[model samples]
Target: MTIGVNCGHTLHGAGSGAEGLFREAEHTRLVGQALVDLLKEAGIYVADCTIDKADTCQEYLAKVVSFANREDLDWFISIHFNASASHKGKGVEIYTYKGKQYPQAKAICEEMAKLGFENRGVKEGSGLYVIRKTRAKAMLVEVCFCDNQQDVDTYYKIGAARAVSQIIFNSICGQCRQGENEKSPGRVQEKSKEQTTFMEFVGAIARKDWKERRIMLPSVVTAQAIKESAWGTSELACKANALFGIKENGWKGRIYIKEAIEQKPDGSYYKVDDTRWRAYDNWEQSILDHNNYIATRSTDGGRSLRYGAVIGCCDPELVCWYLQRCGYATSITYAESLMKDYVVKYDLTVYDKP
Candidate 1:
């Protein structure tokens, strides 16, 4: 189907937009671009209606509506971040024209709430210019309160643009299909098995400069990369270049966002929220980041504190066991999966040699 996406506000106009932990204009554009990419990838025709420069708000709204109408879009989505004077507001909400709740809008809100935001529910927005003016079934999504620190942290933690894009894509485009024949919206193709071979994975790790940071066994690193990223076929690996499922904390570099399941205190596995992963420029950077993660502590110039037991260990099996004990993943068979299925089956220990 055809859809129109409005990024909301000019870079400098729209009265400076909202400012929380991040500028609303930047976040809106980022999320809007991501949504467009995802829609296109899912085989939907998309028209970008974002106004980068507008003399007036009235002019901006008119141009956006005009474009949507001209394109004869089936739906229009206006992406924006919410703001509050007290900076205490949080959660996700959507706006539809006054009369009734739009299914797509409701669906978007539901998917967004799955990222752990409060579901503020769909509300009437007859007064909203975009909603009122668009000819198609239209909705304005207020992703989260930009003024709230907790909300901002959550937004970044779960992946700012990438996470929001998935929610919107899943809500509108449904599931993604595999082959060349495009399916209807709401049906995504299931992902296939690992695409890269074990030797290729080992070679990738071996080519990296892990000499100084060889605290974690190379074989262990290779196995975890394979298991976690599915041999470079997982969305996080392919899209974001995140090989080890490392969550974004204080990373200042690029980010890749995706939904991740986590184990709770009760040992029940639940899709906790979208995780923001550090996006690398290349696969080698991902490998290096993985190396640094398991090798040292914050005090020792590394990012983690739990993997000390595995650090400096040369045995792949021992490293896997130690990582499992450190709660690297919730799977009860995580260690065994690496040891038996990956390391042993692939003969990954050869890569650990100096």
Candidate 2:
């Protein structure tokens, strides 16, 4: 099946803060390119549909719809960052029509969470043109909340685009096996069993021994780390050497840093110094922290479904979708960005090596 990837917007005057101005339109374009590169490496058909000069989301969506129709693509994934007036929220999220398209939507969302990302959950939308107009299964991923410094710092790594591309490659093609198309060099290859394991559930940990585990594909891990740690360039990653961007926000024994940001209790934005996460000293610490965070939420009484939906069940994309439903971040485009980048970047195959 053919797939299309697009960055949510051009880099020019894109806003930051809760307004999303941190990344220039050019940065978004670069991110888009990273996604395309990863997917192509996985032997998947990837389409390039970034028109960075567009002035508005409406115009951009229209261009994407037109391209999908003309290309006859089987799926369309739009990449984007999220913004909010309040920087209190964060995490990964996915969006779909919330109706019949929910199945594909579920798949997309789960894949993202498995790739790492605070599960935001899948949401239903009638206003999103890409999902409404495209003939193929369309989903959008909001990698993280740009407004939230923690989210932004965690997800906006310099090499995040490339990392995201790897995850998307594994998610869609995780069912395929390695070397399945070796005989026909020109044909697209399928994902190997390694593409669908737990390592795929979170970003790469940089653990040498991890190779022994029958974990998911390397691309997926890379994407998750990119999304969570901004491709290993976040303050947490750089200072603490935490590659996966795990936080001990509520833990009693863990260490963390605090930062100031705008927050809203009811309506107006207010300054708040929330506890920020410190990068883990080692990959295992980060992974264990992440696991605890997810597992703890999974048992939070009546809120299990909501949390479960965010992380999703066995399906990786569903985890992303559930995060959206949980309001992990305000950005509507998180999940789309992750999937699109992962598929186009050839990152999915990186796991084949030791």
What lDDT does each candidate get? 0.73, 0.53
lDDT of 2 by residue, 1-354 (tens): 578876666434432112454653433444555565455434355566555445666676677688777777777777766766666776766777654445544554565555455677777754777778887777776766666777655554533554555455555556322233334434432345544443353434523323544333334345555555544434455566665444454555545564322223321122224546655666567655554454455435646643544332433345455555675443355455444444223344454355
Runs of candidate 1 exceeding 4 Å displacement: 176-354
Candidate 1, residues 1-354, lDDT tens digits: the string is 788998877667654478778878877877886676456433356776777667887887888888788877888999999998888889999988884687777887887787788899999888998899889988888999988988888888888777887778777765532222234322322322333353465555643444665567777788777677656645677678777778775677898776665545543333334578789988788888777766543543456566788877767788899988887777666787678656775667767766
Which residue pairs in candidate 1 have backbone atoms (N, alpha carbon, C) closer than 3 angstroms, thus clashing? Answer: 173-186, 174-186, 175-186, 175-187, 175-188, 176-188, 176-189, 177-189
User: What TM-scores do the predictions have?
Assistant: 0.51, 0.45
Q: Output the lDDT of residue 337, model 1.
A: 64
**Residue 250, model 1, lDDT:** 66
In Å, residue 156's CA in model 1 sits off its true spot by 1.2
Give the distance in Å from residue 204's predicted Cα in candidate 1 to where it truly belongs: 31
Sequence-dependent TM-score of model 2: 0.45
